[model samples]
Target: MTTFHAAEQGLAGLELMAKIREFERRMPLLSEEGLIRGSTHPSLGMEAVAVGVSLALRDDDAIASNHRGHAHTLAKGADFGRTMAEILGRADGYCHGKGGSMHIGVKELGVLGTNGIVGAGIGIATGAALASKMKGEDTVAVSYFGDGASNQGVLAEAFNLAAIWNLPVIFVLENNHYAQSAAIEDMVAQIDLSRRGEAYGVPSFSGDGMDLAEVYELASAAVARARAGEGPTFLVLDTYRYLGHMAGDTEIYRSADEVEAAKANDPIEKLLGQLIAEGAITADEWESMSARIVADVEAAEQFARRSPFPDPAEAFTDVYAKETQG
Candidate 1:
């Protein structure tokens, strides 16, 4: 497998990370305008983890995401316009506007779905990995969840199953310090989440999620191991979210100082600065890139706004599968 350090791949990853950031940054405004109806979780500061892990995988490798999943979905190669349309409840969405932001599943992209239920993706991804193994495919599956999900029993079960069956799966824990209003410390007895996978004999690793290079390096190793039939690996990515747990959150649990401190290590800026320092990209190129990303996001918004909503009669259609004629 090729590493993300290659010049072209690095630049592509940076651009994708920027696009994910810009896309989620526009969410609050859409929410305020009532364009997004439900609770939308923004993965503002966690772009590096998403892009890094995604860049390590092939298009056929599957991924299951949690509520704060826009980054994961987009990073996994979903269409920007359709993602925005889904959030806006438009008919052109991946789920025909029925699944909204939390339930986007693009089978063609191997993005199994972005679930609303906490820790649910663990089982889904594990099942996907099992299927791939049963089919004798080399593809691996990834499950993305937050620090809060670390405490869920499903994680332990998935770990055990993946280990015993030698299924190819990667469990990525984005430890962003807080689980909604509750801090990670208050929610779990073990602060170092990387050790959670050790009990089940799954090799675990931890890294700074803000550093895209570090994330990519670690994820590449994990992906390689899984593809080699070495069973599952768990990654504890220490990152933080700049936004609230969800839209309309008062954010009373964390201090303003804490938020500002986390913003200082903004992942997008971190990678951008590194690229400039290494002479890989000039400031002018970055400016141009940012402008193009912003324009793309705006166009997606317009597309979602112009697209029609799903018809009421269609709700019952996709719910059940119709029998095929023999």
Candidate 2:
């Protein structure tokens, strides 16, 4: 059994890396053939955020992820097949094909929903934490957003409430260093994004989000503090997004050398290397795992492809959580 006590041990070294690679390899295909519509934010280089946070969270703990959130939903234990189907607008998807890639969630699984608006879900998580406090539940709520979201005024407001009320919430800033096309430096005057939380008096810390062990460690501390009623903790996850902002991005803003530089320290590669060195996985065994992941993703795509899209009329029904009209 994986003990949550040691945050490092919470993450499964080999298996987690395999999942990240699987998604990275398959996401391109999804876009190429038009299976996934709208903007799909590939968490290709930022797998550590999903895997690390999921490992640290209890089954009942809640989460709201960014628009680029496939890994976030899957990391929290949502069925991959269903998520893909949701992206494809199939009836079998997480939201009966209504939510699409931006709105993946299972309330029972404590995934509130990934919001399409930047930093909007921070408020959702804050609200969930308040509800938990009211119900006398110890469960914590987490919100995952990117550095770009730091610019949004709503985020600052959410942090203030979480701090003043001492709500059980963790705000994870997945700082991939780019807000759309511009780099983090150009986008914000303060590069240390975690410092933003200081205004709310929320204890804030940054971490190497590309490292599973590091992210797990930081998240465990944040979650524990929240559970102990110490209020919110803002965590800046220093990571990278391998793909462009969107599927059709020209990506000419940055040099190819910069991409190469980021890839040089690819999170998946680092994790796999560490596992191999530690004797947790051998070369041939690792190769087998890679092969299996590729096959599994392909099979999942096939399943999504075969699934039927929901009836067009159903779209109007699920758009809002409405009651009877007089």
Candidate 3:
């Protein structure tokens, strides 16, 4: 067992950190290269929520995500090659050139998918959990959405449905303080988003989005509670997105200094610093990990570039059963 203590060397814990770092860095570069056609809302400063919530899921567990989902997809174990390829408009991608950057799916890896619609994944996760309960399966469901999506009435309705039926699901709200150009304080009636879950009689808690260990601890408890037939739990991960709503967001919304200041508390930097301080990882280890991640990401990018675009005819084919397609 990997103890959260310094004694365990915290190796597996580092992998989660490394994963987040790679995802955060590679996503923007892919977009800049004009490979990822759809808009990308990078979780630049909010790695902890994805890392924490993912630890709560198993191979059979399903996760549904919203627009800003690179962290969620990576944490859910989507193949970096295919994930990037999907973003790069390649046929070998998760959607096989169908669902681009904002819509990636790998069912075998437990990522049901990333939806473009706000608060849409909530219903999907709820329905999946209900199915698991009825089928007597141990599988649980997780839905990762932004604080911005909380304004959607569908989320409240999902909370009600999950609570009344005792479905095995976890709702992770990554509160990054903005909904496009609107600030969290400007839009929400109560900045305490957890209160919305409480209103539906669901037990809700907040977690530190920059601390993976803290996230893991909270998520573990939430997962166990839901699977034990205790019902759903709402988690508000306090974090921020360093990137704008998309790649070329205007500075009129916020100050450049604010972005730089937020990067100071970046989860990857904080994790690496702690690992070195605790002697769990040496300088060389950090260097080696960085090199490996860079090489891997570069290779995936090359693969995506070489991959062919999906055949236009194929889209009409997956639309129906074999008989219908034939």
For each candidate in turn, the TM-score is 0.97, 0.93, 0.93
* lDDT of prediction 3: 0.81
Candidate 3: which pairs clash?
none
Candidate 2 pairs with clashing backbones: none
Candidate 1 lDDT for residue 205: 88
Local accuracy by lDDT, each model = 0.91, 0.83, 0.81
Measured on C-alpha atoms, candidate 1 has an lDDT of 0.91
**Could you tell me the lDDT of residue 55 within candidate 3?**
66
lDDT of 3 by residue, 99-162 (tens): 7878888878878789899899999999999999999988889998887899999998999999
Q: After best superposition, candidate 2 residue 55: deviation in angstroms?
A: 0.5
Instruction: Summarize candidate 1's per-residue lDDT along 139-216 as a digit string, tens digits.
Output: 999999988888899999999999899999999999999988899888878898888799899999889999888889
Candidates' RMSD to native: 1.4, 2.8, 2.7
Clashes of each: 0, 0, 0
Is 1 or 3 the stronger prediction by lDDT?
1
TM-score of 3: 0.93
